[model samples]
Target: MTNGFCSDDFAPVKEAFDRNFKELGEVGASVCLTVDGDTKVDLWGGIADPKTGDLWEEDTASIVFSCTKAATALCAHILIDRGALDPAQRVAHYWPEFAKNGKENTTVQMMLNHESAVPAFRDPVRPGGFLDWDYMVARIEDEDAWWEPGTRNGYHMVNFGWTVGELVRRVSGRSLGQFFADEVAGPTGADFWIGVPDNFAKPLAPILPYAAKPGDELSEFSATLLAEPQSLQALSFLNHGGWNMNDPAAHRAEIGGAGGIANARGQVAWYTALATNDGRLVSPEYLATMTRVSVATSRDATLLVPSRFASGFMKSMDNRAHRQGNQASAIIGDSAFGHVGAGGSIGFADPECGLAFSYTMNQMGQGILLNERGQSLIDAAYKVLGFANNRSGAWCR
Candidate 1:
């Protein structure tokens, strides 16, 4: 049976959550949603550790991969609201070293919108070198742009955290971890963290390594481009070696793009603050800029798919290229903005619905986007809000 509570209006979400473990292959997971600052659903179940059969608990948390990008984007918005950062200013103005390799023209806004053109380093990266922030930042600073700056958009993948994190550090004079803790999580009381503290670090659920089933089961995208050694997709994800989410060092290191650690409740609380414009993180004026569509639709250079982005979050769009087999594509109303993690995890805020939802799990799914397990819950949530029937491209303003 699924554990935790749900409001009567949200009982369908819990039903879907339970079906995930019974019918789908959910190992360990949590799903939470908040509407207009009130949490309506919270649930968790299944085995966090198959070896020991440890049941997932209320406090259990795990890596949410690229979901961290949303948190990093919030950090940038905080700086923007404070007038400490100007999105229009050159990134080099804050971090002078970033000006090297013909990147002097790249603006901080471009970095946020995935248009900065330095998605990954061309040189070989050491496996654990990401643990050293200075090294990563220096490498990115010295690396040349993969395309002309500000002309196109591409998923920054691994480099996003370092690039955004370094900008946060340079401008705020605090590490991204420290800044997030003092500014965002501390104020909102969310248990999420960019660098999971040493005290709350251990006994975290680990992401199950992805394994393909028999007989050409891997998607053509995964097989052809993401698996190819020299392709940008492979290099971006594998350059730092296979990340072990359970490692203590991984918890301590602030890989803001890929290393955010949080539970479903934590994400819900954080996004609730965003959805309600509560001013706990940033002012509502800046929140509009943060959540609004910044870049129009485009074909991502590295991901080889149509992607629409705003600041640091993905937009809900009707790109048919992104719709096929994309369980994680914008199923939420078009006005929503949030980021999905590498595996199945997804967290987003729909201001129009005053809804914030998060799903986190230890079992990694094969899809690049949200898997069936998470999508089922989202569908149930929107149905309750009377917007399941309104998911056309026009839902976004």
Candidate 2:
């Protein structure tokens, strides 16, 4: 069921990957890891489409949902590193229209840190509005801030693509997708795409939604999504203009917050540059700023769970004991920074250990964060690196 290579020292990761298929119901997935800028594990297996029984190949790409945020954030940071954008500056300094509706004080950092107070649309989005970049940008510009911009934080969820992505477009004079292609993916040779092109030849894996058992409980965020359709939790995730996530059109649309398409190898390759500080992406100083925790809260407005975020990326967040239904946690090295997708997909750079790790799968998992299948692999990697435990919410030596 599994195929690929694993370094001798990282054999445990391969075992964990296999166990995901045997025990955790992983459908189609790929996991890749790099340490000290060396490829340590690259594996993929299972059926790409259960309906057709097609096999997952070496280059099969799947929608990696919110993991795209890391790529989007990296593009913005590149512009920041080049003096083309400033994080601390008011966002209106670049996109003048964003200042309207109590957002005059919204800084670029606020947008990246999820403190922009525009986490979701209060009104319903028009059909297919998410696919229209201009339409979404205009909507965000015209919408009122939910609260004072800098007072607190909420997971921006889907709107993150447009909010920070617009800044990338305005300041860099290029669309977010193009900027990522030209600057990040192209230079690093990562086979990830913000907007998949028509000629994309690799086999695409269709996502299989998670199925809940009879006794499965709902997370607080899930309960809110069900009970309060107008709440930020629901609006952020459910107000997406009724776009079919698995459709080809959605793949072509550049929804940077949740529409990235890639395999595990592509994510690991991209993160390797950052993990090694290889000078291809950003300076070490800027990388430090990007990885440092920017905001943390016991209860996220959207997710309704403990959360920690860096600028445009997620830090190690252990919510195992914080809730009853979904005890999901993204427990990586303390210094690691990355984003978890809507399901189980994850990608991160642990600079402390010179490791870049990623796991991508077509089968959606039951949680807003890393599920057991993905976390098990992470645990194995950390153990091989001699990390003691994730006792303090993050793995440490």
- Location of the lowest summed lDDT over 10 successive residues in candidate 2: 320-329
Per the 3 Å backbone cut-off, how many clashing residue pairs does candidate 1 have? Answer: 1
Cα misplacement distance, residue 168 of candidate 2 (Å): 0.5
TM-score for candidate 2, please give it: 0.98
All candidates: TM-score: 0.95, 0.98
Residue 1 lDDT in model 2?
A: 95
Deviating ranges (above 4 Å) for candidate 2 = none
* Residues 133-201, model 1: lDDT tens digits: 888888998888888889998889878998888999999999999999899898889889998777874
lDDT (10s digit) by residue, model 2, range 1-397: 9999999999999999999999989999999999989999999999999999999999999999999999999999999999999889999999999899999999999999899988999898999998999999999999999989988899998889999999999988899999999999998999999998889888999998988889888888888899988888889889888977799999999998899999999999889999998889998777898789999998887788878899999999888786652345888999999999978899999899999999999999888898898999999999999999988889999
